[model samples]
Target: MIKFDGIAAFVATAEAGSISAASRRLGLAKSVVSERLAELERILGTKLIQRTTRKLSLTENGQTFLPRAQRILREADEAAAELAARSGKLAGPLRLSAPVSFGILHLAPALTKFIQEHPQIEVSVELDDRFVDAAAGGFDAVLRHGAIGDSRLIARRLATSRRLLVASPAYLEREGHPASIDELQHHCGILYSMREGDWRFSTEHGWQVVRPKAALRANNGLVMREAAMAGLGITLLPTFFIHEAVKSGVLVPIDVGARAEGAELFITYPRDHGASAKIRALADSLQRSFGNPPYWDRLAS
Candidate 1:
């Protein structure tokens, strides 16, 4: 008989791409996960994985068995959830991923309150700007801005915030603000490195794009915001990042009669995650915390 634990260990290791990562997700020791994988192979009388120092790959047999194993685990998890729900108690480990700036500035406080309310749930959060596969990375959920690309994940929009053209008073005082979108070419720009420095706006005539000359470029939003606040150059940033600065008079918005586009923030999870108790609890708390208008935008208003 194939033990459920052995099957779960194999599935996690396969998806996570390594024993160490799988162990972290399962909250199990490396030795335990390795032993379970080895035992699963022994019971089946077949080698299931090819392990080298650099990486782990599934053998042909392992590849064929992976989907079936995943199905079995999903069914088992659903069954367990049903029982847990009956008792009105939830207890499990939840792994989450989020972007660095938002995670630090926003998610941290929300997570603190969530943990306090649900003492039985063990939570782990990984903050990074790099895109991660939620299912393969073993994350229960992840926070993202803008559209979600993966078809296998379901996204729930938490809130929406507009991007604004902003600069320090000192910079605007010295260089002067551009009177129109066409004149933006003459000014220096602090830009987010991941995106093309193309600024888009809604004008009465139609939409317009301005590819600004970047004087300073950084991958992180906080870095770009800091540079802009230091009188480096003008930057287009999400209101959530600079709303306080705009309110405090540290940064001022430059309205050139162009309406900025808004971006939606989402909490996404794998479709196969199947009504996870911990995920549902955290999602509810976050939605309520952010509210409809979002607290930051309210502060800005």
Candidate 2:
């Protein structure tokens, strides 16, 4: 009979390049890792690795065993995950990631309420504009706006984010509003530096591109909204962050006749996390909070 622990240690040592490295990764002592590997070699009646002062090299038999060992470990993990899913009890740390603006305006409040419900679950959220690697970074879920590039991830549409060309009524009165997309060249624009140097729009007439002279450039969307509200210039913004401002008459939409390409909000996680109770609970709570046609979609309508 082959011992699973010995096989796991052998695989880890192979992947990590040494017993010491494997021990660090597995949270075990180097001696334990070495003992497991030796036991595995004894069972197989073959020396799997040649330990040298300079490096660790795998023998021919080790090369053949590596793939099989990894497969077995993966299968065992999958089986454990399936069993955990069937139990239906969520009790672990759940890591999440989201964009800066949306995370603050929408997701933060919703998460606060959900955490109150599941007090046992520890939640950690990372807010940034860049996309997070959910699997590698240990994030259980991510809330994202705009297009998702990776085909490996499964995305569930949580909301529709309408990007409106808007400015304060005071700014419109003082500088005159852009009646058409072409007229934007005459007005000062608040540019988001990360969106590249130009603004691309999809209209009924096909695609139109504009590169307006920016009076102020900002990396953060909230600051851009503030700049626009302070009568700086016209800015393209998502409804999710500006819904309250639009309703309260702080900001008014401009060039409404020519609409820009609206972005979508997705609640995405690894396909593997689908079976995790903690991930599922958080996802369900989020859907309940923001998924009913979404608040942003309602605002746009």
Candidate 3:
């Protein structure tokens, strides 16, 4: 019979990149993790991973079985979670990731109330702007802005994320607002340093690309927003967090001749965890907290 402990050991070792690392993650002794891996290899009558002092790599057979192993663990958890659902009591370790800005402005508050309501549940959150893999990171759920590109994950919409080109009143007054999308290309822009592509606007004809001259560039949205508010240049920001500034007339939305393509606030999880009650609970809580219009978007143009 296949021992789940051994399978888990093998999976952890492979993912963690070292037995010692896996031991730390699993809270098991390194020797115990090694023995379990050896036991698993013996039971299979084959070597799964090849070891080296410099690096450890999975053998061909191990690579083939890795996905199957992950599936097994996922299904096992789903079974236990289904049972917990019947009791309607949330009590499990929930790991998730979210973008830093959204995490700070909105997610943190929602999570505070969620954890208060489910004190028995344990929650771990990672706040970063970088892309996080639900499967690789072993997250129960991940909150994200924009679109879900990974087909392996399931996405649930929490609220609208409307991105807009905005500028301070002083900047527009000094530089003169663009009369149309085409004229926007002539204005100075405060851009994101890690921006993927050129600025895109949805026009009457179709989507159009307009790249403006750069006056300032930043990697963080907060920094970019501050620069725009300080009369740097026009920049694109999500309405969810910048709505207050816009409402107070600190920044003015530009609608020269087209609309900026916006994104949605959503929660995503690995398809394997589709049946997890924890994911459902968190998603439901976030959706309810944000509501249809989202509190921030109330006065946003």
Which predicted model would earn the best TM-score?
A: 1
RMSD of model 2 against the true structure: 6.0
Per-residue lDDT tens digits for candidate 2, residues 259-278, read 68777888787654353556
Whole-model lDDT, model 1:
0.84
Each model's C-alpha lDDT? 0.84, 0.78, 0.84
Better of 1 and 3 by lDDT: 1
Candidate 3 TM-score, true structure as reference: 0.86
For every model shown, the clashing-pair count is: 0, 0, 0
Residue pairs with backbone atoms closer than 3 Å in model 3 (clashes): none
lDDT of 1 by residue, 114-184 (tens): 88887777788999998877755656788898889888899888888878899999999999988888888
Q: Which whole-number lDDT from 0 to 100 does residue 2 have in model 2?
A: 79
lDDT of 3 by residue, 195-247 (tens): 65547878878888777888987767888899999998998888876898999
Better of 1 and 2 by TM-score: 1
**What TM-score fits each model?**
0.90, 0.70, 0.86
RMSD of each: 2.2, 6.0, 2.7
Clashing pairs in 1: none
Residue 217 error, candidate 1, Å: 2.2
**Candidate 3 whole-model C-alpha lDDT, 0 to 1:** 0.84
